[model samples]
Target: MNVTFRCPPELEQVLPRPVPAKVGLPDWLRRMPATAHDEVLGVELMTVKKCAPFLDAMGYGFLMPLACDLQIDKGRLSWDWDLPATPGETYSRSPVALHAAAQVRGSPFEKGAAPMLKFNAFWTIELPAGWSLLCTHPVNRTDLPFRSLTGMVDSDRYTDNFINFVAEWIDPSFSGILPRGTPVAQCIPVRRESFDYRFEVMTQDETDAFRDTRDSMDGTAGVYRRDMRVRK
Candidate 1:
């Protein structure tokens, strides 16, 4: 999946040196220090399968609830998942916008309740200079999928709130799925040393967690159906 962001013009002028015009996580990470976790506020990207597991590993499962909040807060962005009527077509879609509802089944908590997480919207944001950072880990079909979630705060308070949300609430609720150990490979910084700029701090992993989830649903009757709404 690809996460795209429109950098504010004012802030865009002060971007850090671009990482050697190459594509890949190492090149991207080497360009910026993992310590630059402070200058990010919001992110916009296509959701990928690998990201789900990475988030779970990082103890970020709590954001599942916030996924719904972001939808209401950020609103939806125009895009397409390119999923077709069949499973083969579904995998063909690249950089798809994944909704929070797709991740959880039935009610978020109850047996028949609707999903509490809803992330259909693309993200948009405005923050103080050096206050927020956005990143994207474009997926390579042959390589392990690389995805990202931007950090949007200057203080630990925001990070702490996120951590607490994951640890105290999300973790307990989804304990069965979360893997042991920290999920994130590292938290990097965004810098502006030259005219060229880069804005992304990525957290990466090797497993195809998202793909695995979707694959697991394969052959399971009534698993990948699209939703239908009845208007009054």
Candidate 2:
């Protein structure tokens, strides 16, 4: 599916372009060992680094990056952006904003939530008809200092403006620079569809099939990768 990403003329050259998530994989994933010694089993076993599904999820879709480096010192956020603003118009020129703490009340993040960080996106995304964009925290990326709240937008219909990402700050005490090009959001284009729901007990054939699959998985490594997974 073809998708278009556009930004303000002033930001076209200033901001980093969005890229596939596979290209921005965290360094830990690249450095992790494929196999590790399991103390319980007293043998070397494959780690998640060798798991196809886990890797696939990590690399799926595209990443929206931070527009500029942000300085966080003792829970205060600041930036050094000096881009020229458009004449005769008013809009946020900053790369980030904050939502009131009350907005997240009653949610798990509410208890200790600092002002929720809002990544002010400069780019506007447009997807094909019948498609929406799923914006979520970078999958399996617990290393980030914040967790992006999940949301879906009908990008196909709302392509006129930017869709900012809201996130729960993980560490108010984290004092450092969140550099430009760091992924603030992971976006996946999802085709709209309806589903019919059904629930049923396993039949004899289904039971046998399930057992066979389970036994194969228990007996060998990469059974799903070798026999079931569709190659990307």
Candidate 3:
């Protein structure tokens, strides 16, 4: 599916454009050992770096990056940008905005925390008809100091304005600068649909198939990767 990302001409030269998630895989993932020795098992065990499913999940979509560098001191956030405004067009000048704590009162993110932050988006996303954008935190990025709240936008229909991201400030003591182009949201296009649910017990044949698959996987690395995984 073709997706469009539009921004002001002034921002086109300054702001970081979204990137393919696979191209933005975190440094930790690349540095991790594929297999580590396990003293308890007396053998080497494959780590998440060698897990196709885990790696695929992290590389499944596009990454929305920070428009500018944001400095976070204690719990405060600030940025420095000299953006030129568009004639007769209004948009965010900063990289982030604020959401009053009262807006999330009684919610899990509240917890007496200071105001939540809304990431000021510079681009407007456009998707093909019948498809929506699922915006969530970077997959498996627990190292980040903030936790992005998940949201869904029907980009197929709503493409006029920015789809900003709201996040809870998770680490008050974290003091550092989040550089420009740091991924703030991972977006996946989803088709609009409804589905019915079913619960069932496996038939004898299904059970046998399951056993066969499990047996093939046991004590064997890359069984699923070699035989079942679909290459992209």
- The C-alpha RMSD of each candidate to the native structure, in angstroms, is 24.7, 1.5, 1.3
TM-score (C-alpha, index-matched) for candidate 2: 0.95
C-alpha-based local distance difference test score of model 1: 0.27
TM-score of 3: 0.95
Q: Which is the leading candidate under lDDT?
A: 2
Score candidate 1 by TM-score against the native.
Answer: 0.19
Candidate 2, residues 48-110, lDDT tens digits: the string is: 998999988888899999989999999889999889778865569889999888999988878
Tens digits of per-residue lDDT for model 3 on 25-83? 99999999999999998988899998999988899889999988998886777888888
TM of each candidate vs. truth = 0.19, 0.95, 0.95
Name the weakest run of 10 consecutive residues (lDDT summed) in model 1.
64-73
Which residue segments of model 2 deviate by more than 4 Å?
none
The alpha-carbon deviation from the true structure for residue 226 of candidate 1, after best TM-score superposition, in angstroms, is: 53
